[model samples]
Target chain A: MTKPRQWIERTIEVGLFLSALLSVLVTLGIVGVLLFETVGFFKTVPLLDFLTDTEWTPLFSEKHYGILPLFSGTFLTTSIAMAVALPVGLISAIYLSEYASRRVRTILKPILEILAAIPTVVYGYFALIFVTPLLQKVIPGLSGFNALSPGIVMGIMIVPIVSSLSEDAMHAVPAGLKEGGYALGSTRLQVATQVVLPAAFSGVVSSFILGISRAVGETMIVAIAAGLQPRLTLNPLVPIETVTAYIVQVSMGDTPTGTIEYQTIFAAGMSLFLLTFVLNIVSYLLRKRFREVYD
Target chain B: MTPDKTKALSADPTHAMEKDIAFKVEDLNVYYGEKQALKKIKVDIPTHSVTAIIGPSGCGKSTFLRCLNRMNELLPNFRIEGEIIFDGQNIYDKNVDVIDVRQRIGMVFQKPNPFPKSIYENVAYGLRIQGIKKRDLLDNIVEMSLKKAAIWDEVKDRLAHPALALSGGQQQRLCIARALAVEPEVLLLDEPTSAIDPIATGRIEELLRELVKSYTIVMVTHNMQQAARVSGSTAYFLLGELIEFDETSKIFTNPGDRRTEDYITGRFG
Candidate 1:
């Protein structure tokens, strides 16, 4: 009974709603699949055993299923990556926002962005070939496939994310606040560090959280460079396997569908998802706090 | 159309000036690229008194205030000619450190722009940057500055609270306290009370009157009444030129320039 124009508008409205719902549906589907397979994984391996077991050698003749090794590996690499990225990215953002001229910023910003555009696979190979060999010369005991090289490479890869986002946050701070600082006779460095950085604290913290989440979920870089040995050790000189690397290794191999070993990837994925979800929540809370202060 | 005050000010730049001059601006010309913002400005600001610069928007009043602290140099393509003599040295001299100039001539803006920090930290920031790490000294200075700014009683209990939590007027007072913490010789205010409500504006005017007892104050304000109420002397500017400079009472009652009189009487901005 509707007119043609009214019908067309209704159709478009439905289509837009469907488009919005599609992403949410896909996310729910992913969570359902991960939960289903993780449940299947727990049927064979007890929860306590999965949590407490130190060795993660499910593929070997003697099987073990502790999540600790993967957790430790992921933790170690992410820590190293953060340690490298935090200072470097923050400093670059300060230079870009506070010190660099408009022309210099225009030139330098795209160069930093290009670092993000570089393929992770390329970075993986770079970690294995160039960085590892160089580190081997400097630190004699470093293995060919250790956590250090891949960690550093991953840090280099995520620098753009931290810098670009943090810079946006710093840029968002009111110019009036900075003017107030300069009026108080603060030098350029003091204005940047004391006023701008603190004012943009929530945004900067959000960047750090995002960078850590990206490092945790990173696959190819650690898979190719960091060896597939899931050992519960913090030593960067030794080979260690991250949760993502193990998932990648399992997904690539000839393990049959729904097998306990294959289902292990889903359980590992769930843990990764949960960790990133927690990080995102923390970032959201911090950003909310910032909004409350300013608004 | 008698231009008595204008002729006197233009003929002798230091006419009716106090012996203790805080600043001597001589042949000052400011340009932002091709456009001139301030044209051939010459005036002497006396110490320990409020000197209000009154003009319509874009008349270079704010530009003139910023020049005293060398804040104009921070902008792109901003150039200034002539001398701004402060502390017996030309602040525009190549060898004179800008940091030192700013330290001596602190400024406040139209809107209260407090840092997103604790009330205590906001006041203590100036000394902290100067590397004064002593806890007792910082505590003493923060208390003294807050008291001087007339916000100590309101904010004393909430020193740890965020500065942004305060009302707009309180925040302005906090900013004033922050500026006072550094103990600058001159405090430049660029329409500081324009953003606040009348009650807040009255509080600030009264505070300024109290402050002029010790520190030199140069403020740019659009409000003629505020200039009359708070300032000792008033400089009337029109189209980037100083039209008249005289006592606040004389300038209000009988302006020297026709432009100054017309603008003051609300005939035209």
Candidate 2:
């Protein structure tokens, strides 16, 4: 009986190890594929041109391969998303963490989480059909498929992500510190801003970084709403194509596998991966530093 | 009873005229939801003296202390009846600004809780919240407050260091300095030395004796010796009631109540 139990336990341990190893193997496989395809693409397009070229017209007859226009579009949309999400998400977090009653929080948190649960494709259509038209009424010159609409919609999409994580950070602040602030005659606002916010600063900052990473990696909303124009303009009023949107466009079209146009998606995928990779590392570092300080 | 008559009776008639009272708590009943934490408590905490509230764990001594500065209001389902009169006005009155009340009554907690900022920033925080932006003034007050807390000489050179990096004793003193930067009228300490070493506790007790000269001191402590050593008057609480309130000497030597005697001796808390 003991031998049979031991044999079963050994099998289970090996099975668990293999399950854990599968995820790492898949991640390594992705990195290897991205590297191979990117190197192949770089052989046809020089690294300098890829980095410094102002325009990206690979599918067009012109055949320019500069990654800058796509990068600028990605940066512009992400900026708008950050601008919308940061203050709104942070304020919501502060309200939920510092001001809201337990009952209100219990009711409100699920509703906010539901906002996150909505499909990104629905958000995409909403941006194109609803948000753009609304903005056109106000601004008059707003494009039907512009960066601003998708950018704002993406911001709204990620608000729960930013607010939920940031609220968790603020809530982790010790009650004694808050009571100390109150004992010194600090008003509720003063305590929230002065003491709790600063003590939870690193975690809040990490949450923002993660939110930005989500905005950078988001695909469906930008693909459906932000138009297929790889213009290197900061103007949110004009239609722009982000890196993710460009990949979706190439993948859906007749780009022909093993062609330079086909390989552009992999190259674009590499850039997006690298950008989010750096962001995740920074976020992880900040979170670790925060743990050292408080714990 | 009439308001005047209740006031006259609550304030010890023997010392009512002579004693300078900082707080006159009358029929202050505290409830957390349906459960009562403190029964009808009436006591006149005198000014410029250390008045210690001593009792066993879960005796509502800390709850009574928290009520003086209205800190109990932060808890959910917390309800209070009766009045805590401070500066001749009922602090719990609807017209009274809680912010203003808190500024006058500062509290030090059991564990050292300094903001994870520089020592200088922690001390200046209270003043900064009040919109006191003058740098020179803040510097002077921070120095004075730290000196008063008896940690200036140890930390004078390292004001820019993170407060959490300091020893626990120094951190506690930093909290004290932070509280003092606002120059509150009454200082409430809830087991301030319970988390510190014997040496640190002694230094804090010595600091309290000096502080009472300028600010009214109300303390909640479990250590009977600490109450006898630092406080002028002591209030013994059992369960949720103020069993006895009198001179520290009398309470230690000859308590008015049998329960107080039972507690002060090696009997059950």
Candidate 3:
């Protein structure tokens, strides 16, 4: 009986360990595949031109494989999304966590989460049909398939993500800190902004990075609302294609499997992964660099 | 409860005041939801004097100390009954804002909570909250308060550094300086030196002794010797009741209540 029990324990332990190792193996496999294909893309299109060229018309007769267009697309959408999400999400989070009565918070939190749970495809249509019309009233010459619509909808999608993460962060701030704030005769807003907000800065930054990363990787909404024109421009009112949207466009079309066009998707994905990875590292390091240690 | 009685409770304008006291309490009781933490605690905290509340763990001395500044009321289910009269006004009156009460009466915790900010910012925080933004004004108060807390010389050069980098004693003194910067009428310290070393504790006690000349001090201490040394008046508490309150010498030398005597002599907690 003792022998069987010990053998069983060892078997279970090994199984758990191997299960944990599978994630690492899968990640490495993905990196390997991406590097193999990105090398293929760089062979046909020079690495410097791919990065620096003004145009990104890969499918057109006058071909230019500039990666800048996709990067800027990702940059604009992520910026607009963050501009929408960060303040709205953070303020709502502060209100929910700090000031809202228990009944109101209970009612509001689930409603915010449900907004997040709505399918991204539905949000795509909402952007094109509902949001673009609203924006067109204010700014003329706004394209029907523009970056602004998808960016705004994507921001709405990430709102719950930002608010919930930020709420959790603000909630984790020790009650002692807020009590100390009150002890100094600070008003509720002062305590929330001056003390609690600073205390939860790292968590709040982590939330923003997570929200922006989500916006970068978002596919369906951008593919539907933001047109397939991968033009390198900063004007949000113009139709533009993000790297993820471009990959979606090509994948849905008849691009031969073994061609350079096929490998370009992998190259795009590799850059996307690197973009998000760099964002997480940079924000976390920046937060830690200037933060005050409470514990 | 009526208007005329309320005026009389605050003391009539024609009446000549005798002892300068910080707080006058009546039938003060505090409860955490269902369970009572303090029962009928009635005491006078004299103005410009150090009053030490000495008790064992869970004896409600800390709870009583928190009641003065309405700090205990911050807990979700905390409920208070009766009145705490301060500056001839009931601090718990319906019209009285808890923020205003806390501003005039400040508190320091058992552990040094220095906001993880710069030494300069820690002292400036209270004044900043009051909306005085002139940098020179903040600088002067920060210097004066830090000097008053007796940690100015050690921290003057490192004012911009993170407050947590300071030693435990220095951090506690910094907290004191932060409290002092607000110019509170009364300062409540909840075991301010419990976590520090003997030398640091001595430094803090010395600072408190000097501080009582201007601000009234109410300190909760686990150490009976500390209570005997620092406080002008001492209140002995046991099981959520005020067992005795008198001059520090009387409580330590010849306490009136048996429970107070037993606690002082270390017969039982």
Candidate 3's residue-wise lDDT over A1-295, tens digit each? Answer: 6999999999999999999999999999999999999998888988899889978887777888888999888888888988899999999989988898778989999999998889999999999899999999998999998889899899999999999988988888877778778888888898899888887888888888899889999999999898888888889999999999999988999999868888889888999989888988987896787455555
Q: Give model 2's TM-score for chain A to 2 decimal places.
A: 0.98
Write one digit per residue (lDDT tens) for candidate 3, span B1-269: 58967776788655725447799989999999899999998888888889999988998988999889888766778999999999889999999998889989989988887775789998999998888999999999999999999999999999999888999999989988998899898999999999999999999999998998889999999998899889999998888999889989988898889888888899987
DockQ sort, best first: 2, 1, 3
lDDT digits (tens) for residues B13-109 of candidate 1: 4655534789999999999999999999999998999999998888999999999999888899999999999978999998998888888898999
Q: How does residue A2 of candidate 2 score in lDDT?
A: 100
> Order the candidates by TM-score, highest first — what do you get?
2, 1, 3
* Candidate 2 residue runs with Cα over 4 Å from true position: A290-292, B1-17
Q: How well does chain A score by TM in each candidate?
A: 0.97, 0.98, 0.95
Model 2, span B1-269: residue lDDT tens: 48977887798767676768899999989999999999989999999999999998998999999999999999999999999999899999999999899888988999999987899999999899999999999999999999999999999999999899998888898899999999999999999999889999999999999998899999999899999999999999989999999999999999999999999996988
Give the winner by TM-score. Answer: 2
Q: How do the residues A207-252 of candidate 2 rate in per-residue lDDT, one tens digit apiece?
A: 8998899999999999999898998999999999999999999999
Instruction: Estimate, for each residue in A55-116, the C-alpha lDDT of model 1 and write its tens digit.
Output: 89899889999999999999999999998899999999999999999999999999999999
In DockQ terms, which candidate is top? 2
What is candidate 2's fraction of native contacts? Answer: 0.91
- As a whole number from 0 to 100, the lDDT of residue A250 in candidate 3 is 88
Q: After superposition, how far is residue B128 of candidate 1 from its true place, in Å?
A: 0.6
| Model 3 backbone overlap count | 0
In model 3, which regions exceed 4 Å deviation?
A: A101-107, A138-140, A287-295, B1-18
